[model samples]
Target: MATHLITGAGSGIGAIVAERLAERGDELWLLARSAKRAAELRERFPAAHTLVGDLADPGKLSWAFGHQSLPVELDSLVHVAGVVELGPVGETPVKVWQETLAVNVVAPAELTRLLLPQLRLARGHVVFVNSGAGLTAHAEWGSYAASKFGVRALADALRAEEHAAGVRVTSVYPGRTATPMQRKVHQQEGVAYDPERWIAPESVATAILTAIDLPRDAEITEITVRPGR
Candidate 1:
């Protein structure tokens, strides 16, 4: 069974993906901000290694990973932890912009760097759960869009640098999904939250699983999932 590490594994797309992987009998290492949720996941998936901490804090992440007796190799590293702070460029707060980039971009990059040795050992896959915002910017989404764009760049750079090492890097650009984060976005936009109008997290999770299940020799560089009209 493949050993997988997933950040933001407590909720939304991350939670669904972790559950699916656990069901498939893959060994799971889950990182989330909630200790309670971690405990619940540990109870549900007895073999899972759960860590409660903030992904944006490199020190905490280092401590969590270091304190654990994890395997030397990992089959996949799925980066699903992210935050959104929506506002037009002129009106956005500097603090919000900083936090957005710190969590959505820098944290993932640092975590991946720390895990590169393990990923190389297994010739594993790195999946970034990016958003359609990463592909195209929209009004009032300046901070979020910019950060996701950085994620796209990060994935592209990693793919180019690691292909020779057999470490496949994929960036998944999923359109607005029916997630709590999407609901919050809708609230900010003063629009009704309609599940049917958005992509389902499960669909995105399925796509990620497909990427992970591809032949070791094949790499799906990018995947864009949009809601049907």
Candidate 2:
């Protein structure tokens, strides 16, 4: 079984993906921002390993990538950690904008750069959990949209650069999934997007696993899964 490392593994899509990876007998290194959440994940997947680090911090990201305690290489990396900050362009604070960009774009890019050697060793895959916002613009989501667009571009470039090295980069655009982040968005906007109608977390997790398990010759470049309605 291949070894997988997932960031934002504390909750939402990240947590769900970790659970599924562990269920499938894949060894996992879960990175969470919170110690409590890391402990919770450890409890949920007793067989899986855990790492606690905040990707938003440059030092933490460096520590996570450079630490010798963990394996120097991984067979796959599922980048599910990102931020969504909603506000009109003028109203958004500089700090909020930085945080969003850091988590959604800069952090992932830096992590990828630092971990490139490790991935190259394993000739592994990179899974980016993107958003529909990355594909289209929406109101008051400028920061988030910009970050995701950068993410998409990064994924595309990585795929092109690593195709010859047997590294597969898959970008998954999941629209309106049921997660705490979505719920927060709904509360702020006063729009109750139906959970049942939305794409379930497990469904998206399945798509991720499928991409990881695919034969090296076949590549699922991009998958956009949304609510049926």
Candidate 3:
């Protein structure tokens, strides 16, 4: 069975992807921010493993992982965890940008670095669940958009650097997915949240799966998922 280490498995698209992979009997290593969250995720995915590391402090992930046991070889490392804070550039504080970048970009980069040997050994895939904001910035989305954009760049450069090692990288840009993060985005935007008005988490999860499950000879470099409606 393919083994995957996934972040953001507690909810939304990450949760769905973990469930689908588990249903197929794939081995899972889910990343949790703390012991409490690891316990909760263990309850949720009874057969999966959990890793404790705080994404809020990317600088410490190396030290944290040093104390934990990581997979010897991994078929995939999925970066689905992200944080967003909506505000105009003039009003957005330094902390907001720092938090957004920490969770969305820096942490993923560090995590990938930590797992590169395993990923290379298995010829694995790296999936980044970026938002459409990564491609285009909109008003009131400065901080979040900037982080996504940074993540997009991270994906691109990693793909180029790791291609010789057979480590495939893909960035999935999902548009306004109906997730808890989307709800928070709506709250920040001062608007109503209608789940039916947005893309389903399952669709984005499917996109991620497709990229990872593709034939070894090919690579799906990027995918943009828009609302079906």
Candidate 4:
């Protein structure tokens, strides 16, 4: 069975992905920011491993990716950990902007950097769970959009860098998903954004699994899933 490493595995799309992987009998390493959530998932999937570390911290993420004594190497790396900082551009705080980039951009790039060796060993796949915001711009979403744009750019570069080495990178850009991040975006903006009625986490998870399970010779660079409604 393939061994998959998923960040932001504590909830929503991440949680759904983890569940589907486990159901498929794949070995899993679920990374999250909360010990409680990790522990709960561990209990739910006894065979899966859990690590609670803040991706925003390079040192912490580094340790979780490599320093931990593991009997198995990861065959797939899915970066689902990201933040959405929404506010009018002029009112958005510098710290919040930095934090959003830290998780959405820096963490994925660094984690991919560290895990590439392992992925190369297994001829594995890398998945980036980015946002449509990464592809399109909007008002009051400058920081979040910038970070996701960085994510899109990073995935593009990594795919090129590792293509010859048999490591494939796929970026999944979903629009207005019903995840906590979307709820927060709407709450902070004080608006009614009901795009969630169409963009389900399970559908995105299915698409990601399909991408990862594709033949090594088939490289699906990027896919955009928008809410039907």
Reference-based lDDT, each prediction: 0.88, 0.85, 0.96, 0.84
Task: Please write out the lDDT profile of model 1 over residues 100-170, one tens digit for every residue.
Answer: 99889988998899889999999999999999999999999999999999999999999999988899999
What are the TM-scores, per candidate, against the unseen true structure?
0.94, 0.93, 0.99, 0.93
Shift of residue 127 alpha carbon in model 2, Å = 0.4
Worst 10 residues of 3 by lDDT: 92-101
Candidate No. with top TM-score: 3
Model 3 Cα RMSD, 1 decimal:
0.5
Ranking by lDDT: 3, 1, 2, 4
Q: Candidate 1 clash total?
A: 0
Global Cα lDDT for candidate 2: 0.85
Model 3 over residues 75-188: C-alpha lDDT tens digits?
999999999888889998999888988999999999999999999999999999998999999999999999999999999999999999999999999998999999998998
The C-alpha stretches of model 1 lying farther than 4 A from their native spots are none
Query: What's each prediction's clash count?
Result: 0, 0, 0, 0
Higher-lDDT candidate among 1 and 4? 1
Q: Which candidate gets the maximum lDDT versus the true structure?
A: 3
Q: What is the C-alpha lDDT profile of model 2 across 193-226, one tens digit per residue? A: 6677677888888889889889887999999998
lDDT of 4 by residue, 47-77 (tens): 9887666777756777664546442466799
Output the worst ten-in-a-row residue range by lDDT, candidate 2.
63-72
Please give the distance, in angstroms, between residue 84's alpha carbon in candidate 1 and its true position after superposition.
0.8
